[model samples]
Target: MKGAALDTPHIAFVGAGNMASSIIGGLIASGHSATCITAADPFPASLERLRKSAPVAVYNDNAEAARSADIVILAVKPQIMAEATDSIAAVVRSNNAVVISIAAGVTIASMQARLGPEAAIVRCMPNTPALLQHGASGLFGNDNCSAQQRDFAQRVLSAVGITCWVDSEQELDAITALSGSGPAYFFLFIEAMIDAGQALGLNADIATKLALQTSLGASQMALQSDVDLAELRRRVTSPGGTTECAVQSFEQSGLRKIVATAMHAAADRAAEMAREMG
Candidate 1:
């Protein structure tokens, strides 16, 4: 709120799984006081893990974590969100706290209906990359949420990585397919490249290292360089050179079209899940 307030707000995570841990880790790393954060998880193992690194209190019940927190993040799986919210609905409703839901396929209307009308809800789709503090999160807020509430959510999300806001909740499915599921696609590509390198006589370890670093360097360049991808490709691909040959092979194999088709399929499935959940 108010153009990114620097104050460390009290935050609570409803689920202390990997994404929640990543967010808590990023928040602490970014100078948020550990005491300002609390995590609730049903699993004893997860609570133990969170307690080891976070000075914040950990609870087995979601309602206990939501009791005194200004912001409550719902990080449970989509299928279990309704039960998770139901477990803490009374507390959240009583406090009128802002609820940020990261469960895919759970709509804002559904969340509000479950949590209560006065609940300020923000829906976000963040990928696994958040585990590495390089996530891309897409967020959208319901009418109950004020500008301040939205800003608070954005600030918390931005602590981990880039954050983008969408005008319509429907577009969240697209965002889910793009950013939420995009990392796995990149990982698959990296795996394939590693395999190809190994087939070309490189050792497994060397191939994996080269492939991973190449992906990282390429992504970094795209983020930092002013040049467009097409120009960059052309710069590296001389006529009839090795890079050009590889590019031609990829084109011939319809790699670009395949990627586009795959993304579209992912988006379609996400939309279907949203509809099903609704």
Candidate 2:
């Protein structure tokens, strides 16, 4: 909290990769002081990139940076999460810091196994859009977490975008399927729309522009409007209109069923991954 507000707790990042850099940049841009932030990564390239992102202190050793931090963000890959957590497990426990992890499939149980049963840990699943400050994060805190720690976790994630807390850790699997892997679904839809537009005779550039704008505008409408999604769709599907014809085609092709199957598959895979990681 050296350069930040008096009440702001010192935050340390365990990794300095792209996602960590993005979150650090957003935090500083929002209000957190660069003085209150710190990062540790073994690679000089990674630390250099993080230093470029924010004016935070850098360290080559994990414990050196996490030594005095009030919150430690685990931003490493799932496969290496155990090793990363072990590196700073003592510091996290000694400082009694709230550990927030952004690695998907790294369960709280797995972290507790390394940090101890009484350790406060929050597991989060954040999609790539977080780099653009439009992310949706799903968080689940172990029973050891306090109310204040939960709020702090929410604030940290909110610097990137919105956050939702799951009542049970198990629900995070579905949340992962919905928002964690959700961006790719939208991207695929946008790509399909652009291709359709091009096939319908529009040039690629124009089609791409139109498709992106339409997607953005429609999302804004859904977010800002008070009406429900089904009602909004009904408004566009006028009887015997082109939109109606398209809707009919989608229904005839069982689009809803297709979506359900894909989402369930994603959720199941997420659960399987967690088990595999452990």
Q: In each prediction, how many residue pairs overlap at the backbone (N, C-alpha, C within less than 3 A)?
A: 0, 0
Writing each residue's lDDT as its tens digit, candidate 1 over 1-66 gives: 221253666788999988999899999999888888988998999999988877779999888887
Off by over 4 Å in 2: 1-6
lDDT of 2 by residue, 146-186 (tens): 88788778989999999999998889999999999999999
The 10-residue segment of model 2 with minimum total lDDT is 1-10
> Judged by TM-score, which candidate is best?
2
TM-score of 2: 0.96
RMSD value for candidate 2 = 2.0
